[model samples]
Target: MNITESIKFNKLKEENEALKEQLEMAHYFNQNLGKELDKLKQQILYKEDFDVLAEMYYDYCLKDNSKYDKLLSKEGE
Candidate 1:
């Protein structure tokens, strides 16, 4: 190849190598992001389950207090 053509080819080859490295890094970053998204979805589901259970427990406590008050009144009398 002529001198100018050879220089251009070498520069192009270097650029290609740099682009490949960047592509690999982006793929790896995307995979990790996918994993993190899955984890976040699971955490949200767990939080929803916990919130439902807490609400149920609170409702039960409110209902039970009435019965407890009767027992206390009986004991005092």
Candidate 2:
């Protein structure tokens, strides 16, 4: 190839390599974001379950609802 052609080919090759690297980085970021979202979903589910259990305890085991109210107020503070 002529010198100009060789230079153009090298430039294209470098651009291709740069694009591949960017794609790899984007894939890695997407995977990590998915993992973090899963963790957040699990935490929300856990919190819902715990809230249900707490409500059941307050409704059945406790004679006075005032204790539950106090706990709620403490949390707000």
TM-score of 2: 0.61
Clashes of each: 0, 0
Highest lDDT: give the candidate number: 2
Instruction: Write model 1 residue lDDT over 6-66, tens digit each, in one string.
Output: 9999999999999999999999999999999999755533334444677878764344545
| Backbone steric clashes in candidate 1, count | 0
lDDT of 2 at 18: 100
Q: Which is the leading candidate under TM-score?
A: 2
* lDDT of prediction 1: 0.70
State each model's CA lDDT, in order: 0.70, 0.73
Tens digit per residue, CA lDDT, model 2, 1-77: 99999999999999999999999999999999999999975553333444678887876454675545444322333
